[model samples]
Target: MKTATGCTVISNGTAVIGTGAAPIKDATIVIRDGKIAYAGPVAQAPEVEPDATVIDARGGTILPGLIEAHFHPTYFNVEALEDLDIKYPVEYVTLLAASNAKLALECGYTSARSGGSLFNIDVWLKKALECDLVPGPRLAASGREICGVGGLMDWNPDYRKIGMDGLVLLVNGPDEARAAVRKLVKDGVEWVKTYPTGDAASPDVNDHHTLCMTFEEMHAVVATAHNHGLKVTGHCRATEGIKNALRAGYDTLEHGTFVDDEALEMILERNTPVVPALYFELASIERGPEFGLSQRVIDGHQETLEGGAESARRILRAGGRLGMGGDYGFGWNPHGQYARELSFFVNYVGLTPLEVLTCATKTGAEILGREHELGTLEAGKLADVLIVDGDVIGNISLLEDRKRFIAVMQGGIIKAGELFRSQA
Candidate 1:
């Protein structure tokens, strides 16, 4: 909550820069009033203030603080579809959301864009974070996910007489979709999240390849959201759904799992950012059985994992923007483990460590539309930087280990890691 007023100097580290260039050895980063003034080789760094606070990186890797592009601050320990909304009342879920926000900040995520939240909780969560009432990432809230009546999120049976209103807004047609986007605009959401297709979670009903919202409804959502100066993203899995989203002008695509050649070409042509969110599928396949998930569900997740990884590889190879972060509040993939997505991409999706880092930092900010302000270590950007205990390029998994975090800075203020603890 504190605004950093004095100048600060971070030196003696290899800077990754988050610009896809080669890492700079013996780099120095200068901060002034919570903005980066310089970031480059020490030999070319400008002279610092005489009484500036100095932080030694200790031969660690300096890079931009990570951005969780497909966050869900409202979901916690979700084991089943019902667990997302029915397991906890809205009041309790709000508290849990606050806790998850703090955990994201401590885990080195300086910014996040909520993929979806319950009861528009992320809107209020963003306000609280701004007021310093709770610690959290810089959030772009999507109040609630927009889905069709029998979509992937509407898993509760009609006989149960329960509504999915807590987590999703179920619309019947294009008019209803437009109305829903208006409601989100009134609720102060920065992005509109919609479901263009079902998910692997609902195997029998609306599986991964099944379309949920029609193309007309999807078009209505994008048109309405864009009119209000808000971007739109979709939970797109099927090939047709991906094309529909692209045709409807969706700003981003989540879990674009079954993208085929046509969808891939469309995604590249539109320059749309895609979040594979493959880690969630990995977790479901590897650990779902322990949580009583049925064999069918596990197999569905396996299929989703393979399809998503392949699509992600193709997108990256075609030079499309691939963002990181998604579905981190499940029982298998809990909060505070957001960095696992980075490692998953590097290890399983065949991305180099540096490529994955750029995806998490630079492309992530671009997806959020804050690239000029939040991403990279370049001058004239927010001073959100991470100092890892070792060469993160050499050991990409080092970022997943909290013990290796020497400092996590947001707006030039030390928020977590060794430096914050020492100050405390």
Candidate 2:
């Protein structure tokens, strides 16, 4: 239900404002015209009109809606990589993408940025969400990823005559790189995804340490993306690849696993956001055998798990931005289990719950360039709020329980949660 123009108040909650501020006890949130008119202690809450719709939070935790910094809407039940592009036709994949978007919103994510998608599905998905044809998160869409021939994403054999074109645009040189960025711009993408390094999943040919795209190609991609008013992020893991991306003025790094001191210095200097995406490694290590992955692949995932966690810790200690989101939509780590990434960071990565929450909310928004309006529960910001039935600060895993989500408000409307049915 749309919030009335007069007011809608959320009362009797403990506010865990996403600005890293301490939780405010007995907090109240006032919504007016789809914006936060006030959010503070209940005693200080402004007077509301008599007809205002007041939803009682019942002493729950109220925080900003979570943001998924690296989302892949087209990757569902992906046991093998071919499931990403080849197994399902584009028509079925589009429907799957729409389902994943709604799943993300129901899981408490109100905003997301596409890490990559098949057939530029996320571009049209964003429009569908805007028109309310779909119930989903606000999205910053990146079409197909840009990959060098024989890179991590280029798994299909050329002789098969079935290319990787559905998921990635394979480019050979700097000119092709620029042309690929132009294609993404024409497709109406807000961000450009690139593969600068290979993955541990492809250990034999292009392992984690190998660079996929040349420095010149990387630079051309960044330059062209920036020129066309789009930001570029890369699946960077190797030290050299990370350095190349940073030197090329890339906007963000995904799975920045092997950051040496030199790369750390560069990252801190540039103030770039690094999404460790460590949860995917953990899932791979634990469940690879079930999916017919070889022992070598499992070992590679174990190594990546350790290295990515350590890099994330170092980045956090050095005051760098460490956002949260991982490669979900696989068989083990499915789309609705998005909050597991936050739990993994707190339990395994040695970060406090509050720290992980900040990464998922505040830093995640900063990475999307929407921090000013959507990251925090402050006055004058968009009324994107999540009211949990428990103290999420004390038990961060409470966010994983959708039943505990009393209300999930996006733009002051009750989009999902236990209270949504009554409100609608």
Instruction: Return the top candidate by lDDT.
Output: 1
The residue-by-residue lDDT of candidate 1 on 205-298, one tens digit each, is: 7988899999999999999999999999999998999999999999999999998999999999999999998999999888988998889888
How do the residues 83-122 of candidate 2 rate in per-residue lDDT, one tens digit apiece? Answer: 6767888889999999999889989999999999999899
Candidate 1 matches the true fold with a TM-score of 0.98
Give the per-residue Cα lDDT of candidate 1 at 336. 87
| lDDT accuracy of residue 151 in candidate 1 | 87
lDDT for position 356 in model 1: 97
Clashing pairs in 1: none
Overall lDDT per candidate, in order of appearance:
0.92, 0.91
Off by more than 4 A, model 1: 159-164
For model 2, the stretches where C-alpha displacement exceeds 4 angstroms are 1-4, 160-164
